[model samples]
Target: MSGASNSGAALGSLLRQIIVWVVFAAVVVVLPHLFTSGSSISMMSQMGVFILFALSYNMLLGEAGMLSFGHAVYFGIGGFFTLHAIRAVNDGVFSWPLELMPLVGGAGGLLFGIIFGSVSTRRAGVTFAMITLGIGSLVESSANMFTDFFGGESGISANRVTEVTLLPFSYGPQIQVYYLIGAWTVFAALLMYLLTRTPLGRISNAVRDNPERAQFVGYNTTMARFVQFALSGFFAGIAGGLFAIMFEIMTASNVGLIQSGSVLLMTFIGGVGVFFGPIIGAVLITYMQTALSGFSEGWILYFGLLFVFMVMYAPMGIAGVIVAHFAPWRAGQLHRLIPVYALAVVPAMLALAGLVSVIEMGYHLSLAYDPSQPIDLFYMQVNVTRLLPWVVAVVVLAVGVALLKWVSGRIRERWNDINKTTERPEAAR
Candidate 1:
């Protein structure tokens, strides 16, 4: 009876997981159909690109426990190769479809990863990170200095209307591009997940947890790291290729330190220890970049602060926090807390908006602009506003944050008490 009950519970859990994934996949496919706006489609496509990039990044930090500061080399190389593929397809050098060009990017990344991994994998920890950083800087400087291969600072551009699309659909349609991105994202994600379940993946984890122990157990740690790093590069390259296909161009910025840091932030914030954490981080960060960056010159500063908070308070990340609440939420025990959460959201939104407005105004004020074209604060457009709104915004934000903190503390205390009372004594035993 016990075994049967355990089997049934396991089956139910698997079914629930499958259902969740199915629902998510359905939403991804259906949401774009509901939006006829080009900008929305574009944003979704960019999200897909970032998702791939973040997941690839996680393969290293999450699975291998290797912190890389120069993973952008693989991404940039893949982008460069993708641009060439685009040019070739446009110039009739290859008959392959536009969708197939990303494979070239993946291949390029794999090669670069193998080469770099050979050297970097010789050491671990800070030494490894520093080596990767040096490699990244070298590549970025080369991209800028060498005008021929990199196309100089202007980077490279390709015609999107190439004859390489397998489907009889025109590449000019935003919907087509959206579908291409969606399909690729799913493929890459599935492949990466499968890789995580392989023997190599298991060994990588063993190596991460204890490299010396793994070596003593007869596994080559260096080889494992090299293979892991190379595979990570392959996926990162695919992400770069996706970027090129979606935007029809590649620039130094695509593979620069900023790009590398963004991927790191996404992976770290998503939860480097969990497989799906980076995906969550990628989506959240992409949304913030699109929605919040335009609102503030201090956006980077805010992001830095947020990262610090995550490291200090929620080291496991947003996904980890959600998971921590799963038991109570899943059992419907926390349903009564909805009203409190909703109440907190209003002042929070208002405070955030006002803060963003002040930052946006300050950003414009720093830029030398003509007084003839006035900026509008109400419209949230670029404005040359004085300090009055800024002062008012600061005051409101402080009060709202204080209220939020107080409310959160109360909620957490109640939650802990409920959990303590409701938890089974036998379960604890």
Candidate 2:
């Protein structure tokens, strides 16, 4: 009876996993139909590419506990190689489908990852990070020196709509590109998740948590780290291939320190503790990069502020915060916390609104080409010269901060009580 019960439970878990993947696949397929815009498609394609890149980074940062400041080395190299392959295909030097060109990028990324990882993985902590940074700088410098391959400042471009495609559709439209990216995103995400269940994945985690113990247990810690790094580069390279196909251009900036830093920001902001955290971070950050930049000059400042806030307040990340509530939810105590959460949200919004006003005003004063020109802000023409708007914004910000402090105490007390109640049954068990 015990064995049968275990089998039944395993079967149920497998069924639930199948359902989740199917729903996710369906949503990816249906999203373009609902949005039906060129920009939206383009944005989604970017999101898919970053989602894969961020996940690849997490395989190092989150899973293997290796911090990389230069993962973009693999991503950019993969892209550059893919572009060259695309040119070769276009020239009839080789026959290959556009659908499989990302594999070329993956191959390129893997090759470099193996070369770089061999040296970088020798040391585990800060030393590894520094080595990667140095390597990234070296590659960025080489891009200019080797203008033939790197294309100097002009970069390289290729037309994706050649006769080499396995799919029915020509890979010309943004919509087709979006679908291709989405498919790869799903495929890669599944593989990464599966890796977490494998022996190498477990050993990687062990190496991450305690390298000394991992070494003592007969695992060559360096080899484990090297393999993990190379595998991560493989996926990152796949993302680069998708990036190349989507953009049809590769630049020196793509492989630079700035690009590497951007991926780090995305992974850290998303919540490295959880598997899905980077996905949330990538999607949100990508949206902000694309959508918010059009509206405000200080969007980068806002983005930085957001990262600071997340690091200080919710270190677990957006997904981590959501996951935290599951215990209360399962215990039927979630309803008790809802009202407290609602109360806190009001003051938080007020604080955000005020902060946004101040930021916009500051940008207008400091960065605007013409300070005399009235700026359209939040659907109202606000003169920077006028003092009333400043006064209003300050007052609102101060009041919101004050109210938030008061509400936060109540929220903490309520959550503490709920946690105690929820834990009682588990304690008994």
Candidate 3:
């Protein structure tokens, strides 16, 4: 009877998972209909690439506890190779589906990962990071030297429209490319997630948490790290292939320091401890790049400030913050945080306004044609050139900072009180 009940529960759990995946697939399929524009489709395609890229990165940083400063090398390698493959297909060298191109990139990434991981996995932590950085620098320099493959500064470009596929359709339209990306994104994400359930994945975590213990327990720690690194590279390469397919171009910058840093920022800002964290971070950052950069030249400044703010106030990243609140919400004490959070908003907004104003004023005086032009503040124009405005902005910033510190202390105290009140008596005793 107990065995039957256990089997039933397991079957129910599997059904739930299937339902959830079906819903997610439906949402992905429906999104393009809602945002039916070439630009929007392109943006979503990029988001799909980034989602895989960031998640694969989490396999290293989150699962294996490996910090790679040059992960983009794998991505670029895969992209360059995939571009060549696409061109070959266009030239009628062979026929292959555009959807299968990412697999080629994955193969390239896996090969390089084995070569690089062999030497680097010997040392962990900072040493591994430095070695990876050196390798990245070497690859970037080589891209120019090997212009035949990398296509020099101009890079390589191909027409996905000419490639023969299993289907009668050419991947000419952005919507076609978007669906290709979406399908691959789902596949890569599912594969990576399943990898976490395997013995190798579990042991990788064990090695991450305590390599010495993992070794003592009869596991080869170095081998585990190497395998994990190789797998991460493969997935990253897959993402790179998706990138190439979407953009139909591969460049030196694809594997450069900026690309490496972007993924690192996304992974870190997404909460490295959580599996789904990078997905959220990837989407948020990609959207910001698409939408925010268009708003002003100072968009990078705003992005940098937001990153710093998250690092300072919420070190766990956005997903972590959301997860933190789940306990209170489940306990019905979420309402208590409403007023506390509202109080925090005033200081946060004031500080943001003042800092943005200062940045704008400096940019205006140094770069803009007219320094006396009124800068928009909350939709209201303020003459930033005036001494009074400068003084007021600085004062507001200072006051906001001071008040924020005080209010934070009060909230912390209240938070502790609430936790104490909500504690289970049996455990407390």
lDDT of each: 0.83, 0.92, 0.88
Off by over 4 Å in 2: none
Would you list the rank order by lDDT, best first?
2, 3, 1
What CA RMSD would candidate 1 show? 3.3
1-429 per-residue lDDT for model 1 (tens digits): 999999999999879867866776786799798976888888888888899999999888999989999888888788888888888877887687888878988998999999989999999989999999998888888887877668888899887777667888777888888888888888898789879889999999998999999999899999999999999999999998888887878888777788899999998899987788998998888888887677655778778867997998799988887887777776567776676778779677766767666565666667647532456666654434555666776787787778778777877877776687558653777
TM-scores, in order shown?
0.87, 0.97, 0.93
Total clashes in model 2, counting residue pairs 3 or more apart in sequence or in different chains:
0
**Over the stretch 48-165, how does candidate 2's per-residue lDDT look in tens digits?**
9999999999999999999998999999999999999999998999998998898999999999999999999999899999999999999999999898888999988999898978
Quote model 3's TM-score: 0.93
User: What residue runs in model 1 are displaced by over 4 Å at the alpha carbon?
Assistant: 1-14, 330-332, 336-343, 346-354, 357-391, 422-429
The CA lDDT at 48 in model 3 is 91
Residues 272-291 of candidate 3: C-alpha lDDT, one tens digit per residue: 88788898889989998989
What is candidate 3's CA lDDT for residue 154? Answer: 96
Q: On lDDT, who's better, 2 or 3?
A: 2
